[model samples]
Target: MRMQLETCLAQAGGRSDPRTGSLSTPIHQTATFSHPRLGESTGYDYSRTTNPTRSALEKALAEIDGGARACAFASGMAALDAVVRLVIESKRRRVVCTEDPYGGTIRLLEQFFRPVGVVPVYVDTSDTRAVLRELDAGDVAALVAEIPTNPLMRVADVATLADAAHAAGATMVLDNTFLTPYLFKPLQHGVDIAVYSATKYLSGHNDVVAGAAVCRSEEMGTRLAAIQNAGGGIPGPMDSWLLLRGLKTLAIRMDRQQENAQAIAAFLAGHPRVARVYYPGLAGDPGHERLRRQARGFGGMLSIEVDDPDLVPRALAAVKVFAFAESLGGVESLITFPTVQTHAAMDAAIKDRLGINNRLLRLSIGIENVADLIADLDDALR
Candidate 1:
């Protein structure tokens, strides 16, 4: 039976313990499983290839995203690395991607993939015309987009981009880490692969560094499974169980976080020290209408540009509730300066063009008291 996402998530590992009825998924912490006899198997021979705990998490992830299958990895980069390998397998090895993706992604592509014949192409994915123009050149292997992008909050029309990619004989890969399956499911909107940093919102807490990739088709699922097995970047059983625990509360956490973000975005937009606010949740934001048409909610992320770059350090040092740290998506609010933190590896020119400058501060709103969160920012800006 098809259950609501909330129910599905809440019951992530609920049914995995049919044997002992443990309710919680047990961690099958072992390197290899012994067979009963020769030529016979117990389904799992090696933990690297598969494990009961990880399989349960993978199944939940696939179901939540409405994908054919899912693979869990040690980190978000590992999941992306495996996906990149699949894209580069094409004779046309050129992959088009979002112009301002997470810096770590750019580093992976430039340092690792570029040396091995994989060509990376960057463009403003929210600008359909520009992405279409790049695809028109042909010889494109895949189109990777980070919905609402990182820090900038630029939402792309997924179905339209997916159609264009398919017409050009290219696969569409979406980084759904920000919105996650709770707010948006890229596969349902014609995306062939949905990528995630399960470390963030999917895990909900500021713990467990994990990543996942969900495939839309069985063929792609089989291929990605092979790549996962070869790469051997799978997470341990304990980490997989942690993800399962995180999934159970995803719906609630996301709802409260979005609520807090909407209120905070409004607060930042009207603040004297704030020059610009980049949040799709704001009705006047450029991506607001498009994201509304596609996603269920506006998400919990927003970025602000201070009136003076000098005020950046003051705000960072002044925040009492918000943590001045790296990474996002957790119960505790986080403030990140993208220029030197998340997007430091990106080209300086691209960062300048995208407005990811020293004055810009990215906020990952958490499920805290909305008033407290607002007051904290308000005081920090002062």
Candidate 2:
């Protein structure tokens, strides 16, 4: 019988070891495994190529995302690098991407992919007409979309985008980091590839930094696997084990996180110091209805713009509970000044155009008490 998602997550690495009846998946920490003889071998040879712990983690990820296979990487960027390489190998030199994506993604495309002749085209993916117009130009190899895009929380119509991409002979790659498989499954929405920054929600504690790519088809899975092995960016066995452990509690963490986020978004939306709130959970948000139709939940990320730019630093310093930090998707609530932190690498022109300005603040809500979290923000805004 096929288990439900919550059950699958709760039992992520359980019952894998029949030998000693170990409930936890054992971490196989070694550079290489020994073969019994010249003609025979264990499934794992080099740790770099394969490790028992990583393989188990990968299997769990594939099952969670409903993919043919999943590949683990050292960092989220490394997984994206492998995916880009796969696109390059296919000889489709151009990639259409979501506008206002994570700054690191823009940096990678400009600094790395551009020099190597892979063109990156950025558009507002929420605007399906704009995406279709771009696709009409044609040499596109892949369309990399961030579901409810970074900081802004703008939701895209994934199934519609995927259909357009396929008609244009392109692969649809979705960054499902904001909403993990617990909230949304990209494959079910017609996405060809589902990418994740496992360090965030998947490894909810923020301890392990890892990345994953889940391919919809076995053919794409084989190709991505080749890129992952050749690129040599696989995470260590320990990190993989930690991520697997993290996966076990994904459902509970996400539920509480989103619940807190909804209350906070509502609070911010009505605040005197607040200028705008960008969270799909809010009924007034532009993407709220679309996200409601496409995803299981609105996720725990929200961005707010204060009436005064000076309020940015003051709030960052005054916040009691929310940490003033860089990365997101953890158990602790974080307040980030995108202009200087996560999106600092982004171009000033694009920043202005997208409202990623000095007054803008991104929040990663945690599983904290709703009243306390709201009170903290209210105090900080003052």
- Return the top candidate by lDDT: 1
Q: Report RMSD (Å) for each prediction in the order shown.
A: 0.7, 0.8
- Structure candidate 2, residue pairs in collision: none
TM-score of each candidate structure, all chains considered together: 0.99, 0.99
Off by over 4 Å in 1: none
After superposition, which runs of candidate 2 have C-alpha atoms over 4 Å from their true positions?
A: none
Q: What is the lDDT of candidate 1?
A: 0.94
| Tens digit of per-residue lDDT, candidate 1, span 54-158 | 999999999999999999999999999999998778878789999989899999999998898989999999999999999999999999999889989999999
Quantify how close model 1 is to the true structure by its C-alpha RMSD in Å. 0.7
Error of 2 at 360 (Å): 0.4
Q: Name the 10 consecutive residues with the lowest summed lDDT in model 2.
A: 84-93
Candidate 1 accuracy as TM-score: 0.99
Q: Which residue pairs in candidate 1 have backbone atoms (N, alpha carbon, C) closer than 3 angstroms, thus clashing?
A: none
